[model samples]
Target: MTIKHKITLYSSLFFSGFYALIALFIVMSFASFRAEEFKERLNEKALTTIRLLLDVKELDNDLLKIIDQNSIHQLYDEKTLIFDENFNLIYSSLDDTKIHWTTGDLEILKTEGAYFKSEGENEIYGIKHLNNGKQFYAIVSANDNYGKSKLRYLTTIVIITFLVFLLATWLFTFTLIKKQLKPLDEFHENISQINDLHIERQLATKENSKNEIDLLSIEFNQMMSRITEVYNLQKDFTAHVSHELRTPLLKLSAQVENQLLQQKGENDLFLKSMMQDIAQLNELINSLLLLTKNNQTNPREYESIRIDEVLYAAFEKISHDFKDISIDFSIAESVAETPEILEVKASPNLLEIAFSNLIKNAYLYSDNKKVQVKIYKDNHKLKLSIINAGSKIADKAEDILFKPFKRGENTADSKGLGIGLTIVKRILTNFDFSIEYTFGSYTHQFLIIF
Candidate 1:
């Protein structure tokens, strides 16, 4: 799970457990208080019964029973049994319902002076009475309906309150966590868009807030500032070096051409080879310059251009250099019917360079010095494929085919630098395009998806 979800879940669980414990404590404490209070009420009832029966001159058992039956203060299901010193029943509040008691119980009540206990849902209280120098035992039992009802009501309230608070806690935590982490989500999205072409871009930060997230943004901006500085310096160095070397290379090429015109036989052949070497060196320098120039290409310069036009341009350039090489180019019926299907949004110059490199590679490595180019639509996206019948590249070599200065095992006799595919990959990636190399049915294929 994400950090936001984990934090919210754990926090809500913690608060829920804490609240449940507090609710349990409240119910237990209130129940304890109610039990003690009811016990005291029962004790008071027993003492008053004993005093009224023995101490009052005018009140008799029958009159006292009538008073108890009509008393407003009488508890629910109240029953009382009075025993003399000899353990004989003398008084009972309820005539129909008998109070369960034994001789041993009366003796224990006499010795202890007072007792309180619970019998099922009823509370039992016993007391020893002393009047006119005579001992009497009294036992009473009753159910505290009012107190039990209050407890039940309180328990229900606590449960309902706990449920409501738990729901509130989960919702509040989810919303709060999502709100707090919104900045981080934006940071991830913005950072993912940063590339070597856009190295100068930086994350925005709040000026007044020093919270952890804001601090992270500030630090990220500072780091990007330093990286952009270093990147610019490196780019400047490469451009300057390439520019400075071009002048000497041009001079050397002019000298070689002049010598080739004046030489004869063996001397002419040697000068011709030297001229080829000079041309190769000049091509390398131009490639380096072009690579640097592509990095500095402005996104505003990109526009919708016909892919076939770029392909034809690249083919003409390659055909001029390799007169004997032939290429078979075709467009799918569906794509040919809709000219716009072959159009893509990119820098025209960069696309030509990428296409030229792939076409040249296909021509150079083909067994018959022939290349086949096809354009079609796949899954609603435009795709171009350059196929050649050549020695298949190993799986291990395919992985590094687009890495700088890396060549395939099949390119041992090829007369070109290894950065062509690398340059193509960089240009396509800048335009959010992709390329893949695959070999099947004795043919090598380079597929570009736009």
Candidate 2:
């Protein structure tokens, strides 16, 4: 994943974990609050019933009748017992469900004083002392029906509350985090506006945030500025160095040719060879420098360049000096479907130089005056290839073909510098294009992918 995706994913996960923690705290707080409320209700209801029973008289008769009365008695669902001074049961309203503890065991409440209490078998009892050592107790036993319903209700409330908390917390956290990071988004947009041509843009300085973010922006802008300086220096050096070498090379070539013309046939052969070598040397240096200029070039003017025009023009230019060689050009109508199809946005001069160098390389390789240049395209990219008749470059020479000063094993008294291919490589590379050379028994091919 990209950096932006990773940042968003991690930010969301972090907030999820944070929201989970917050939800846990909220759930716990609500549970504690609810449990305390349940306990408080139990205590208040128990005390009020106990006070009402104290006034009843006729011990057994009134107590039995009062235990079943509509108001206070119906509050109980299971066994209920009342006690007189003798500890005999004054009123017994026992259901079919067995109560684990009766009024006898509930005597523990007398010592502990009036309070709401629980009995086994899901029963709750309230006990209170009457005047003269008499006591009254109420019981409510829990059946499966009430227990299941109450449990279901409580569970539903908890789950609903938990879900709501998760949703609400996530939404709220997302909003807050988005707001906090809004400046980062703005900074990224500002940076994009500063193109490769000018990458010196910096984030707006905020007095409140003199932190790591500010440090990052400061460092990033500095790095881009430094990179730009180095790149410009390399380009300028290439152009200047090429121009400087041209003058001395022309002088040397002129002197060598003059000497070759004056010398005798036997001596002049050696001088002529030297003259040819000088000429090739000049061409190589010129090509290498031109390649550098093409690669580093960012000319202001560019338009729809027809592939056919550039290919034919380059072939004719290189063919002018070499009268002994023959080059055949072929362009399929399939490739010429559109005018702009061959039209790449580039400096015409640089493109022409690159094309010329490639064609010249093909001609130099072909000892027999036979070569072919083909122009074509695959989808969005353009491809140009030059094939020449020559001995295949050995495997060793193939590896170092694009590097400066590297000569092939078969380079006998070949009249050229080794930087021709290097220049082509550099030129193609600058425009995000690729070049590949394949050599076979009598054919050498240079492939250009644009």
Candidate 3:
């Protein structure tokens, strides 16, 4: 799951538990208050009935009933009864019957003076009363319908309010967490896009807040500064060293060639050998310089050129170098409706160098000096292949083919600097092109897709 979903889920659970606890507390408190209030009102009714009866000596049972129905606060199923010491009913506010009171109940009330009890939805109480040497007992029973209705309404309101609170809390928590972590997301995007070419770019930071993300940005910028410094120093060292060595090598090559032409003794043979060695060194230096230059060149400097023209030019140069090689070159169009111009965006010089390297390798390694170069259009792409009849390359050769100074196992007898494919790979990668190799039983082909 994403961080946003995880945060929302965890926070919603927490708020649900917290709100449930609050709802439980509120319901319990309200229920307790309602029960106590109702019980107190019942006690008040019993006391008031006793006071009215004692204040008026000549009050009849019918008169007392009339007073209670009119003056007393009426509850749902309210009942009041007064009994003599002998347990005979003396007065009852109810219509027909007295409250069923056992002797055990009366004895308990006599000793305790008063008792209160609740049964399901109703409350009952009994009290012993004594005045002017006469004793009596009062019992009251009632159901608090108003209290029950208020509690039912209260329960409904609490449930609804609690649900709304949970929903609001969930939304508020998710939004708040997402907003706070947006800076981290931006930091990740910026880091993901960083590469060797974009080493100078820095991650974004907030000016108003110096939170964790801001600190991270500041540290990243510092690290990039150090990396760029070290990289520039290394590149400058390579370029300068190559230039410094190339001048002396060129001078040495010229001196040796001049000496070979002037001398006619046995030492002339030695001078010729020296000249060849010097030429090879000069070529090595040139390759190094070219690789460095390709690395530094900007992609925007490329121009459009006909790919077929570039290929033919490279093949012509290679033919002159290896005249004995039998070369076959062809271009076939898969679809007649395709345009004649096989153009692509690239540096012509880099294209010629890369193609020349492939063509030279094909000629040098083929058993019978037989090489085939094919160019065709397929699926809206230009496909070029350099196929040569040769021994199969090693299975693992493809892994290191494009690495600098890496030679295949089949190159034991061939003369090479091994930077040819390296240069080609760098050039093609910079231009968003692709190259692949195919090794067969009697033919090896290098394919370029543009």
lDDT of 3 by residue, 252-313 (tens): 88888888778789898788878878787777877877766625345566677888789779
Q: Which stretches of candidate 2 lie over 4 Å from their true place?
A: 1-19, 40-139, 143-241, 264-273, 291-300, 315-335, 356-450
Q: C-alpha displacement of 433 in model 2, angstroms?
A: 6.3
Better of 1 and 2 by TM-score: 1
Q: Candidates ranked by TM-score, best first?
A: 1, 2, 3
Relative to the true structure, candidate 3 reaches a TM of 0.56
Which is the winner by TM-score between candidate 1 and candidate 3?
1
- How much lDDT does candidate 3 score? 0.81
Model 1's alpha-carbon lDDT is: 0.87
For candidate 2, the TM-score is 0.58
Residue-pair clashes per candidate? 0, 0, 0
Per-residue lDDT for 72-121 in model 1, tens only? 88889889888888888889885565567777788788778888887888
Highest-scoring model, lDDT = 1
lDDT of 3 at 33: 96
- Alpha-carbon lDDT, every model: 0.87, 0.64, 0.81
Q: Which ten residues in a row have the lowest lDDT in candidate 1?
A: 291-300
Question: Which regions of candidate 3 fall more than 4 Å away from where they truly are?
Answer: 1-221, 294-301, 335-341
